[model samples]
Target: MSEAVRPGAPRAVPYLRQPAFWIVIVLLVVGAVRIAQIAALFFGSFPLATLTAIVMFGLFAVPFWLLLAELDFLEREPAGLRVLAFAWGGLVATSVSIPGSTALDNLIAKLGSPDLAAEWGAALAGPTVEEIAKTLGVVAIVLIARTQVNSVLDGIVYGALVGLGFQIVENVVFAIGAVQQAGLGDRVQPVITTFLVRGFLAGIWSHTLFGALAGAGIGYLVVRRERSRRRRVAVAGLALFGAWASHSLWNSPILRDSFGDSVPAVLAILLLKGLPPLLLVLYLVRRAHDREAAYYVGILATVRDPGLITESELRALGSGSRRGAARRHAAASAGREAKLAVRRLQRAQAGLAVELSRGSDGAGACADRVRRHRATLAALGYPEAVEGARSWRHTASTVGTAALALAVLWVALSALGTA
Candidate 1:
């Protein structure tokens, strides 16, 4: 059966009809009410600290959100679905895991000893409970909108969103805990410290990365129809295990005192714990993105329309870097309008490919939209086909970004008592 949609063909059942949708909604509402009660308690006592944590972690989520948004640029997930994923992580997963992890930790103490639980409780209980809860968010997405998750990249994106949601909410909770632990009178200092340590220093390798790893497995399982069911399930389980193991190691007591409190020592510890998983997730993202890009570009390759997409444009469209280079080449040759035109042209072309893939008759409309942008580019004297090259500007931009990041790290570390 063709995957394409034709007139009178049945559409996906509305989300309202899906039992998973109601299940998710109920969980979200329950979580939200519980979290709100917690927030209220914090606000009644340490309003300033609570506000500070909320604002800081809210800001922290922006960059992660932007980067993840780019992960599936070819076929962006729906905005509503993305919000649902994040809410599941923040509200549902965190709410469930809070009590769940605590109970499991106590059980570990009973099974072993208090000392052993103190040392390994977080490493074991937290990841075991939290990963399962967060992975369920991706499963929920699949249950409600399976068509939206047609690619592995889609699963990664949703999983990352879920992780991001959990990370932000959990950081806020920790920040407030810091304030309470410090016995500070509604001060923001403790909140700032928590932000530096958790939000800045450890944020990169935390929940979001783990969620992506597990999400990759979920994506692979859902999309790889060619693979044997047992193989796909095994791969997905391995992925989830990888996520849990990484999270466990990160939270473990193994390196809590291994390195001294110096800035270099702390950074080294973080790198040791975080770098491997970071590299693995990056490789998966690149691999998934390339495959998705090739599928879409291949669809366009058959169009044989220079006005819509030329050979050079096809080459540029297949790569994130090359796509940016094409826009830059247009901007430098003409003006900012040329860059905008090129972006619109690229979006229209992508839309056309998507419509074609769906077996929809809207290909003509998509092609018309592409032609408008093509004309705009021509009028602006922007040749949208020039390949991008590494230039002095790129080098300067890279150096500048690194320097700025280093400066910020230094300030954060100094504030965090690592100096």
Candidate 2:
């Protein structure tokens, strides 16, 4: 007997037609249900606990959402993946770490004494569990979508986002617990104060910073696999240890006696603890930007295409304000569509350059990337102007240099204020 074909099956099914899509759909449905439950818990009751929970949620959720929305760099990211990352951070990570920490705390209390437990609470509970929980979300992302994390900066960004999500949910619970312990009227001031102090000031240092530190390690491991496996593991361990140390220091009561309710003192703590990580992030980003630029220039240089984009144009694209000016110039000279096309071309070129530098079929890949970018520009009605043009010389250099100068000045002023 001849083998029978599967009934109603396509002879050629695309890989996209696999079970993974349905699994994603089911996960999305479940996530929606969980989010609804959280919303109900946060807002349904008329009790002070619910109100306090809402406040805490606002403190975290607002900033987190705003930051994500405002970040134009992540525009190419898939929405589902982003949501999944946040869910992983907020739900799975939080669930595991909270109960585990509580159990360990209870064990310690029972074994030693309540006083010993209290002593260990901030030292152990806040830093170790919370950092691990939040960072695990980033780890999940790295494991599942390893290719998406191109650089160390990407890891820091993703990890920080996950941490922010966890912090929001955790804060809500903390606020509600505070309200439950204290009466409604008495709870209001503390809740508000805590929201400001924790959500605004300490929030940057808490989960996001810790996650970024850990993520740097994860990113290093993924990017630099050419190195020894043992070395990679050591680097990742060091990153985690650093994150835990930073978290512990931030939660320590060492400053409570010395600083005691002064706004500057609080700001000082934030600067001292938070600024270093942020500066590190900035430095990484700058290096990434420079490397990307150099990679692109090298690729284009092979074809003797110096006019397409110059070093200055690359520098300008690295700056926020200079990029804006480039867009405005494009709009005025060509149109809105052309302006968008130019931006898309820049991004595609940068991405392709990075791929080429990674030794991934350099010539063919670069050609394909250039073709795609050219097609986009043509569709946007800038086919002629975008091709082999020397537009960067006059506009990009001046804008980039000015922006860099302004950034330096701003940093200096900020330092003076603190001093």
By TM-score, the best candidate is 1
Per-prediction TM-score to the true structure, in the order listed: 0.95, 0.68
Question: Residues 1-419, candidate 1, lDDT per residue (tens digit)?
Answer: 21221111113449999998998899999999999999999999999889989988999999899888877777777788899999999999999999999999999999999998999999999999999999999999999988888787888899999999999999999999989999858999888888889988899999999999999999899888878999999999999999999999999977878888787777678789999999999999888878888888888899997988999999988888888888887777787888888888888888887777788878899899999888888887775655567678977998999889867876777667742
TM-score (C-alpha, index-matched) for candidate 2: 0.68
Clash pairs detected, candidate 2: none
So what's the TM-score on candidate 1?
Answer: 0.95
* Deviating ranges (above 4 Å) for candidate 1: 1-13
Q: What is the lDDT of residue 174 in candidate 2?
A: 69
Cα lDDT tens digits, model 2, 295-324, are: 444554454453344455555554445565
